[model samples]
Target: MNDSAAPVAGKTGLEFALLAEDGPARRGLITTAHGPVKTPAFMTVGTAGTVKGMTTEQVQASGAEIILGNTYHLMLRPGAERVARLGGLHRFMNWPGPILTDSGGYQVMSLQELRKITEEGVTFRSHLDGERHNLTPERAMEIQALLDSNITMVLDECTPFPATETEARESMERSMRWAARCRAAFTQRPGYGLFGIVQGGVYPALRRTSAEALIEIGFDGYAVGGLAVGEGQEAMFDVLDATIPHLPRAQPRYLMGIGKPADIVGAVQRGIDMFDCVLPTRSGRTGQAFTRRGSINLRNARHQEDQRPLDPDCPCPSCSDYSRAYLHHLFKAKEMLGPILLTRHNLHYYQELMAGLRQAIEDQRLDDFVAGFARQEAEGDIAAL
Candidate 1:
């Protein structure tokens, strides 16, 4: 996991290039301490230092240039200090590629009654061992530094959905103040970058204020947060509409925790350059397969004797060599291979979609690409051939 050997000479420390654009959609590149990531990219979530069922090599092979880690999980388990002593997150997780770590503000908010928020920070009980922990903007920076995260996300309140403009404004203002602290706490390095998150629920005015505040504090990247909590896709996009126009185009725009395949497509079209979600791998474990036309449940009886690939267009090892019948059998028999294979295929599907999006942006055909995409989805999966 050592990319420390890459020549740092002449490096601008977290450089970015906007290569192409079609409407609001963009194709960009982010240069990190470890390497460069092509955008619009989907960062596979590797919360707790692992991407669940897949190995690091498998994840890389699936076209993931970057993966995400949660500050809360790592800080709770092996402890940030322990990881630093062992050689940081990339080395500890056996992943050499770039890693982005969330500031854990969202998880702490989820604690509800188990936590208390003050002007300085949020104090919460660990879900792992019921231990008490406090997370502040400064401490968040410290934890990410200890983990040696390439992309450090700032601590921000994840405003709950359906909040009034007043409530949202207060929450968003608090996050803006924390963003200032995070910027101050983050140590500058050659290729590392800290991203400030915009939190204002679904209010356009509040979203603008939050984005403006973060931009003032400055960051290598900007993320649209707090929408995916419960707000539907349209609402999320509305926030992005109001927020992204106010963001710095020179830097990357990341839509946090957003979505299904359609959601990613929409966000990428709306100027988002990065994403992270646990849907693909999690659904795989439950016998769900994400195909071009939508998701299919392998647990269904129709798949018991259906001798076909999960997605004929898919080139993943699972689809290339396995049949729907065999996959159904694996799940029915409770074979471990089912989840592993499904996860591999799902990741491949996601990467392929990203590749297509990048190509579309490069060719200035994003509109056409999106139309064809929706048409395919509407047509549904090819009849069991």
Candidate 2:
């Protein structure tokens, strides 16, 4: 609730400007040390300094202004120290745009059987080599700094769904404490930003408390974490309705690790300004393509003879240059190109969705856009050739 703590622009290189809004929907731009990101942005996931099937250029070509890197993965493999010695992640990954590095809290939380959490930090064995490692809030900041991340997320516990109110509170409070430590440990630099994650499970009051706590500590941006993890869409929206209002309007609001096309649209409508997810790329590798008319599986025999593009309207190479039948054949044959081409198209579709949302907000027609998008998705992929 205190706007003074959160400024839209400051001496720091990371800045955000609210250009327009349609009701709760926002259209904005985030300026970082690396570059500028047009809001309602979808950051392609480059988990291990690579976007799986696509190169940095390919990711950039999909209209992505930013990409996310995983501290857990990078530190375990090539090592953050190595990345810094090689001129940071930008040069190492060949990506020159803005980069956001998560604090590894979520990944640590997922390693329930392998990790132990205490007041200081989490200690666990690396999944890659079974090597022991420690990750504290300060250490998390150190690793991201080593990677020279443009946007650094604070370390926070990703509270599991179905957690009791007491358990949620305990996890959220520890995350808040860790966030404060991250802020203290983070180095201030122009064009660089440190974001705090808001945790609290599905409880509204707890969410409010978490938001207020992060606002007090202050951050370049605020992210709502621990959703889309088995919580239904309606419940997720309800949590957003409860949390988004508490977040600073001047700074960007990111919904972490969220979700399908419909989820993004609904979150944007509720005032979320940024997002990242592995769904599009992961689904692509499995032969799933996201079209305007919902998702379709290429491995299904129904597409074996269809000559249409994945989505006739998509301008990506997979759609404009290749046919669904060919795509199907590639998947059937287990060709590597099938995943690459589909991943390209899927990323393009996600970016196009974001662009459409931004345009709708600018035109003050977000309501109409959302309705139409739902209609198209409901109609399903064009009556199967």
Candidate 3:
């Protein structure tokens, strides 16, 4: 993180090039140390070094160019130092493409009763074995560096929702200070980079202030944090409306921990370029599948006798080789294969959605694409069996 006014001379970090734009929506490419990621990209959640049931090759086959790894989970289990010893996360996980690591702030925030936050950093007892650990902005940077992350996020307090203006401002300012420390502590690499996160809960003024402060410090990219944490969609978009204009347009903008398919579209419409979430995979494990006609539950009775593909449009093996009836049977029988198949299908569907959005942005038909998408969603899943 060079704390200096300018980046270390001759050390060019991550590179982003905007190839097309359709109003606020953008089509771009992010070249990282590992590889290139096409934007408006949807990074499959590979928390704990794996995307759950799917192999790295299966994840890659789902059309994902980038995947997200959680610092909190990895640090607690396999350990960051151990990961570094094993040739970093990419080699450890066998995922050759780019990997972005969260600084573990959000996970720490969620450990409400188990953690304490101070100006210096957060201290928490590990859920695994009740052992104590400290995570400061500098330590977060070091962990990500040890993991050899292509994109590392600055550690910022995840401002809780429903905070008063004063509370939000206090949290935002502290996060800004931590952002500066992270910037200074980060090790500059040619293709690896650090992203600064903007925190302010839902207060527009504080959001602007946080954004401005991070910009002053500078980063390889900007991320909108503290949204989707109980703030409804409209409020989240409102925050984006207030915050995005102040961000540097030439660099990538990421919306952290965001959401359903429609949520991604709406954020992209508001100019967000990257997203990661557990929804699709989590939903899949619970018998839900995403489709152009919205999401459907394979556990339902209607699917038990329906012989059609889960989504005829999807080329995933779950759809190409199995019928809705078979999928329903797997779930009903408590078979492990049920979740595995559905997870693959869900990731494939998400990748397809991102590809569609990218193509729409490139063709300057984003509005039209959105229109059709809304129409299909409104129509709902195919008529009951």
Candidate 4:
């Protein structure tokens, strides 16, 4: 294994190589300008230009090949123009690896109040200052480019859950139109690429139409959005089944903000190459840790006298050196190190899970691997801490 920490730099261009295919699950490699990212990879979200407590070196050590940057957060805080002038996001944040930027569409809809949508784009007030802002498809594309994002997402209105079929169809159609405008605005970069997000709210036919329209416009990748936004797993899986087949197999498929271990496994079984979520990091900060067996809450009183590591099977720094009793004390004392250590452990666990999934796919044993994982999960949550 190449363990060197510095950002690997070279030629750009995504060369997605399918090494193996087990049912819909696949083992592949995504070569980017900075380095090669093994799929199915889970990108740690570094919203606000940082991955919470993790240093870039620590993040790399946790096995993340790429990190996600949020356009909305960066644009609001330090301002995108300032970032551009300071030599873009990579230099601004001191992370030289590849960064994928969201188009700020989701933030505009979710974070801002009284949002008004129109054919041109969305008009909403900034959650930070109540300052008015307009985010059109073209402007979103331009903003990502200005940030020098290796991968940029198209601006799509993330439809809220419990939406009626009529509302879902209308939202899907509008997203498709924005996708077209996003495509037209994107400038060609050898290694950089644009991705179109498919939104259909829980309707199968609408998902198919959205997928087909996005494929027509064409992009380096397709992301399934609007799922996981409060829709249960069964409902989300139904939409995936309806949409994945319509997408081109050669390109990568990303499932945005997708979920727990079970959720990731199900999506991989249905064909997804990339994923991103705040669950692991955020949960860690709250004294929760993920393990091979299941999730464990470190804040539970039962761990006050426990001598065991968080997970004996885990090879992370926290598991290697810290005892559950020590961790419990830290949390009980409200120490910042408690969350930091747990975050590292959670990130390590997620990376290990992804490695296991990739190996299983390559060995054509995904079904068996998934079955074994389910069995482990059934073993119940880890003993407190």
Candidate 5:
């Protein structure tokens, strides 16, 4: 696993070995240049090179084997070239684990007021200082390469919600073309690989076309993108049902920016092997904590006098050392420790969830596990230890 500049041929830079399956759930191994990440793994998002409110060590201790980097944010703020000079994202951010960098498409597209889309690329103004910038597929590849991302996602225009079939088709076709360009532009190395995103804006036929197109282009992994943007979970699942079968069974399948716990379970049931999202960390700062039973809000008055840990079954530092009373007081006082502890707890919970999912798949008890999970969730977050 050499993630450094020197390349090794015949090594797709990433190797995936599917070891077991329970229904559509997969228990697999992903060998990256950095290290091995388990399938049905959840990548804690360090969007701007850091997960908010938590140190890298804390993040790792929470059981995250991999983290995600954002190309757009890095390019605009610290600049990708500067990161390269600083020895790439992992070194710059001081995160030693595998890092997956998005293609910068979603960020650019989200800048609706500042960006202009074209067949070739997108021209956008930086929200930081209103600086003009051009983001083509080639530039996207270069930026990610400079960041030294272990997994590079190809640039794809995130089709808007409620798009017409014709509109979605055009957007998907454009993304497919960009995916090809990104593939050509990306400099392959051992332990690093490019992933092509499947985009069809909730249209099954369009998804099929997009999936087939990416298959033809051939990527280290295939990612289902453009669905979790605004679609409800049911619609999202439908798209996955339509798309996953077309992707290569031998390779890894990534479902980008998805979702709540239920959404993840569903995607895993549909054969998604990898996932990344900011929900856990982001929700933490807002006083919400994810527990095996359900979610809890420290800001709620009911927690003010509670003496229990966030989750009795949890073994995270936050759950082990802190009480709901203390956490509630911290949030009420607007103390920094509030977000930090909650973020740590949330990340740990997410990792624990993934571990459970992997184990369930390996034991071929995924159905039982998922059923129990749903029941516990419906039982809601317990107020007492």
Candidate 6:
């Protein structure tokens, strides 16, 4: 966002310190341009430059240190070139903190009917218009640099599940090649880092190969990709169990585009240090709220006359000030406030959850924390109490 293009000072623009380890879970600190983010942090996805209803200040107030931007979305609308002209993503979005951007490869692949892939890159029709465009690994690196992202992800094919072993291997190899190009093209700055993604379907051996290949190319960080698309939790965890051990213990481990509350906790227990997901924001807009227990649908008739807050323990502005009936009324009447309040509450829950996780890891009681979490989830809504 600064767009100064001034080189970052010092070695390893970003530094990860592994302070403690309990079983597979880790407690550490990630140093970034904005500040040092505690490990096991959940980055709210502010795709297209904003986190939906919440303002940047509000997001910070909720204890978020960093946010995510989508390269594909920004590239398509407002254009990366336009954003660069306006002073990069941070200044443009008025968020001065750290920002991490995805490589735009995932969205391009999702455009199944509009895309064609080759050795060079992928050519796809813009979902917004019929306009044709090409995105290669080099182009993705350049785009992230223009965005002034603190962390940039490598452009890799997110191979979907159920593919044949041959198909999965082919896709994995392509992603590895792209990772090399992406690493070569990345601009190194102090506090800024490029991460390589590991992509292999459900095969343990394939996952190991992907991890080894990315390590050989070398990167500031590493991510476990190509999971959670359709693979159930057990399969995802199994892959993580096999893959995480192979990753460098000193570097931060990121699990991309994953998951529900349970998924986050499970992944963390399996040794993931970083995460980004659209569930909290997207589900909020659809009338869902995640509490200490499980998820709740506010659209239920049970909330019609309920006078309690969404979560009695939650300290978010929404839960602190508004009643279930008020939120329910707003949703029933199709008011924008419903989405806004729910979004805030859900983010608050997520941040609080991360805080709890970090504390648990630091205390070397992750197992106990996880056990308590399960018990609470089984206990159900606190509002009914």
Q: What are the lDDT scores of the predictions, listed in order?
A: 0.88, 0.91, 0.91, 0.87, 0.90, 0.90
Model 6's alpha-carbon lDDT is 0.90
- Give the C-alpha lDDT of model 2: 0.91
Q: After superposition, how far is residue 95 of candidate 1 from its true place, in Å?
A: 0.9
Of 1 and 3, the candidate ahead on lDDT is 3
Write candidate 5's Cα lDDT for 1-385 as tens digits.
1223222123366888777888878888888888888878999999898899989999999999999999999999899999999999999989988999998899999999999999989999999999999999999999998999999999999998989999999999999999999989988888899999999988899999999999998899999998777789899999999999999887899999985899998899899999999999999999999887788888999888888899889999899899999999999999999999999999999899998999898889999989998998788745442
Tens-place lDDT per residue, model 1, 61-123, is 999999999999999988899999999999998999899999999899999988998889899
Clashes of 5: 1
lDDT of candidate 3 over 1-385, digit per residue (tens): 1112222232239888778889988788888889888889999999999999999999999999999999999999899999999999999999999999999999999999999999999999999999999999999999999999999999999989889889889988999999999999998998999999999888888888899998889899999999888889899999999999999888899999996898899999989999999998999899998987778889999888888998888998889999999999999999999999999999999999999999998788999999999898788856842
* Residues 266-366, model 6: lDDT tens digits: 99999999999999999999999998767888898889999989888899999999999999999999999999999999999999999899888878899
Q: How many clashes (backbone atoms < 3 Å, residues ≥3 apart in a chain or on different chains) does model 6 have?
A: 3
lDDT of 2 by residue, 128-227 (tens): 8889999999999999999999999998999999899999999999999999999999998988999999999999999999999999998989999999
Candidate 4 residue runs with Cα over 4 Å from true position: 1-13, 381-385
Q: Find the 10 residues in a row with the least total lDDT in model 6.
A: 1-10
Which pairs clash in model 6? 1-90, 8-190, 13-191
Q: Write the per-residue lDDT of candidate 4 for residues 165-202, one digit (tens) a residue.
A: 99999998999999999989998787788899999899
Candidate 3, residue 188: how far the Cα is off, in Å:
0.8
In model 4, residue pairs whose N, Cα or C atoms come closer than 3 Å (at least 3 residues apart or on different chains), thus clashing, are 12-191, 13-191
Evaluated against the true structure, the overall lDDT of model 1 is 0.88
Q: How many clashing residue pairs appear in each of the predictions shown?
A: 1, 3, 3, 2, 1, 3
| Model 6 stretches with alpha carbons more than 4 Å out | 1-11, 382-385
- Residue 304 lDDT in candidate 1: 88
What is the TM-score of each predicted model, taking all chains together? 0.96, 0.97, 0.96, 0.95, 0.96, 0.96
Give the backbone clash total of model 3: 3
